[model samples]
Target: MTFENPAREEIKKILERADNVAVVGLSDNPERTSYMVAQAMQARGYRIIPVNPNADEILGEKSYPTLKDIPESIDIVNVFRRSEHTPPIAQEAVEAGAKVLWLQLGIANEEAAQIAESGGLTVIMDRCIKVEDAITGPLKK
Candidate 1:
């Protein structure tokens, strides 16, 4: 089956109600795209939870080795890892009970999308969360 993202309005509503964002593959370095995107999202008032095993902390938030390690509820599981690596993350997100699974730009995995969708999570692939937020406007608090 072909993959299609949720409609713009649906995406807007998702962003609007979302409060906690768990960013997988978030980099410790400020130079990485993952860092930049998470930073932008944080600036918009979303709590950014960094999921990086190698880092102790990122963007002032304690880093977790995996989604299951996060103690709080996650609204969105924003992934910066490669397409081939996303299926497992999707599974993790499903187990974590996250509301949405978002794959970053240039990354699309049909298997990952299927896993997320089947697990009852909203799936968005090959899209930049930062760009989508910009177009969708400031998130509701």
Candidate 2:
């Protein structure tokens, strides 16, 4: 059977409670979708950690070459890489102690989801994190 993401209520809970989001495969270019999405999340008060090897910084945040390179606790790991490249990212996110693994729109990898799920990290595949937060609105607390 194909994998179905968590229920909407569950996703909303995750969005409401999380803070820092490490954007894997994030791009420094303003024209890229990753940059735009990450910016939107940053505007909404979610700390956006740029995870790109090529850039020293993006959106004024220090960019790490890999998820494992991030020193702090990662609440969410939003991925922008291709489907074929997601499994390793999932592993790194698990190793980095991330609470969630979010694969950006158009990226869905069952193996990666399995890895994350087995590692105790919540998995959101083929969904936009920024859009989810917009839909869920601000937390009531």
TM-score per candidate, chains pooled: 0.97, 0.96
Query: What is the C-alpha local distance difference test score of each model?
Result: 0.95, 0.92
Question: Model 1: per-residue lDDT, tens digit, 6-74?
Answer: 999999999998999999999999999999999989998999999999999999999999999999999
**Candidate 1 — which residues are off by over 4 angstroms?**
139-141
Q: Candidate 2, which segments miss by more than 4 Å at Cα?
A: 139-141
Name the lDDT value of residue 57 in candidate 1. 95
| RMSD of each predicted structure | 0.9, 1.6
lDDT of 1: 0.95
